[model samples]
Target: MTTTVINHIHETTTATTTTSQTQSPPSPTTTPPHHHKQPPPRDHHCNHHH
Candidate 1:
């Protein structure tokens, strides 16, 4: 009986820890800055697509 109670407590603690770790990583929102980095314009606009 005592061993069963201890095992249950250990299982609950491990499960809670795993869940907290999984949820923490997704909180940091990643803002991509690469969109602002565009190639420099040429002296003469030669068929500039964009």
Candidate 2:
């Protein structure tokens, strides 16, 4: 189902953006950090908490 792909993307993108590049962008305009930060607690808390 399409939901499966969306879930996979949500996990992978947030995980990579967080762990792979802590210092990803110095600009506050970049949304990657915001997206990464929000998902850890909402959708991927278990994944990151591990």
Candidate 3:
């Protein structure tokens, strides 16, 4: 019974951690930097296409 309770607590913490991690990455709050990176490649592609 104690073991099961401990296992449940551990599972909950792990699940919450994984859930937070999965949710954290899509924030688009970081997109400005990503867009800075994107323009270089896109302009490179456009220059090459030209």
Descending-lDDT candidate ranking: 3, 2, 1
* TM-score to native of every candidate shown: 0.44, 0.41, 0.44
Supply every candidate's count of residue pairs whose N, Cα or C atoms clash at under 3 angstroms: 0, 0, 0
Clashing pairs in 3: none
Tell me the tens digit of each residue's lDDT in model 2 across 1-50. 89999999999999989865775555553776777677656657687677
**How would you encode candidate 1's per-residue C-alpha lDDT over 1-50 as one tens digit per residue?**
99999999999988877876675444422222332343443323454753
> What C-alpha lDDT values do all the predictions have?
0.59, 0.74, 0.80
Question: Under the 3 Å rule for N, CA and C atoms, how many clashes does model 1 have?
Answer: 0
In terms of TM-score, how similar is model 2 to the real structure? Answer: 0.41
Model 1 accuracy (lDDT, Cα): 0.59
For 1-50, candidate 3 gives per-residue lDDT tens digits of: 99999999999989988876776566544665788677787888899999
Model 3 CA lDDT for position 6: 98
